[model samples]
Target chain A: MDNLNFDEPTRKELQTFIEREQAQSRYNSTVQNMTSMCWDKCVTGTPGNSFSRGEASCLANCVDRFLDASIFMTKTIQDQRARLQASQPETF
Target chain B: MASRKEAFMNTIRNEIALSNAQELLNKTNEKCYAKCITKPGTSLSGSEETCLARCMDRYMEAFSIVSRSYQTRLARERDASA
Candidate 1:
């Protein structure tokens, strides 16, 4: 990889481009995983021509609710850490 | 030099696109196989094939729906945090 001698600006450009692509790729993978999970939860019946209204709405809500659950869990952990640090301030 | 840089960027872009496509295909194969192939027969029956086709379509649709919902939620969270 070091054999390719790119100019500073070109290297920086490529670096940013790759970073953006990686972020996009990560976003795509999350969607794929959530789709599979929500499909199992909402799409119980055999595959029809189209999704029923209930199933479609359930799929949408499932994503939002899952994100909410993640945020809630993160906050809970942060709060627990804060409390622990407060109680044991000398443990530094 | 300019053309070399273009080629390098194109390679990276193509690799990402290929991997993304492969991931989607593998997932669809796993999911639809589970949903459609209830029993392993001598081969795939006609009804199972039909079901798999529909299942693949529905899975893609579901993916888009999820992507949109997640993007909207992420944007809202970012705004709130800001």
Candidate 2:
């Protein structure tokens, strides 16, 4: 509302706070997505009293391997970019 | 003015929290329904109800495990980059 004006420092602080919250929410959503995916993959049978040892390990490894894939893809893209830059001189 | 700003921030925080809860609930509903209610019946059978309960617990456990895995990976990545 019009009356909810935050001063410069307060506005900046609020911006940082919201950004942090957004980052956290993003992380949370990612985990939710991963949980659903891995649950489908690892928990094939009916839900039991507890996760089977295989299901538990699958969930853990799923997250780690997914992250590793993400990092590897990023590195691959960066390497390709470097190669492109080396191959062609920058005109603009 | 201070109280107004505080109220505004609280609203934003509450909204974010509310949406996060909503998302989790929706996902849980979808996943459990899929896993538990394979075929719709006149009503949820006793076994279906039990499966739903167990599915919910396992889903939550999976969420926590994934959360821990991601946090550890993030910390490791940060340390490596630093």
Candidate 3:
């Protein structure tokens, strides 16, 4: 609440700080999700003393491929939208 | 007061950090339990306990790996856009 009245510049600074923190938190949650997902997909065997060479690589590749897939899907959808607009220029 | 603003920002940062830690703990607990414990039992068997310990370690390792990969990707994308 307004328990602490922040001046205009201070408020703007705090807003920027919060936005940065939010971006960071979003990145962190994505990592958390990818970790859980890749752990399941890449780590099939029982937990050993340490990861095998293949397992380690698989974990790394999983994250990269997952992000690639996300970007690809977004691009695909945008392309589809562009195509639709081109085909139907007047359609709102 | 300037001190009050500093204190408020510190509180916000601390809360964010604490929540992040809580989230990691929750995910670790859920994933490790699922991986290590196939069936619910009155007590955790010896093998299940061992599996849980190893699973916890691996989960943390996986988190680090993903964090690294994501950071690398973010940097690459930023460089590309710039």
Instruction: Give the worst 10-residue stretch by lDDT in candidate 1 chain A.
Output: A1-10
**Best-fitting candidate, measured by lDDT?**
1
Q: Is candidate 1 or candidate 3 better by TM-score?
A: 1
Regions more than 4 Å wrong, model 3: none
DockQ score of each predicted structure, in the order shown: 0.87, 0.79, 0.78
Using TM-score, give the best candidate's number: 1
lDDT of 2 at A24: 86
Give the TM-score (vs. native) of candidate 2.
0.88
Name model 1 segments beyond 4 Å from true. Answer: none
**Which segments of candidate 2 are over 4 A away from where they belong?**
A1-3, A78-92
User: lDDT of candidate 1?
Assistant: 0.92
Of models 1 and 2, which has the larger TM-score? 1
Q: Which ten residues in a row have the lowest lDDT in candidate 2 chain A?
A: A1-10
Write down the lDDT of every candidate, Cα atoms only: 0.92, 0.88, 0.89
- Model 3 residue A27 lDDT? 84
Error of 3 at B32 (Å): 0.9
Residue A66 in candidate 1, Cα distance off native in Å: 0.7
Per-prediction TM-score: 0.94, 0.88, 0.91
Candidate 1 lDDT tens digits, A51-91: 99999999999999988898899999999999999999999
What lDDT is reached at residue B1 by model 1?
Answer: 84
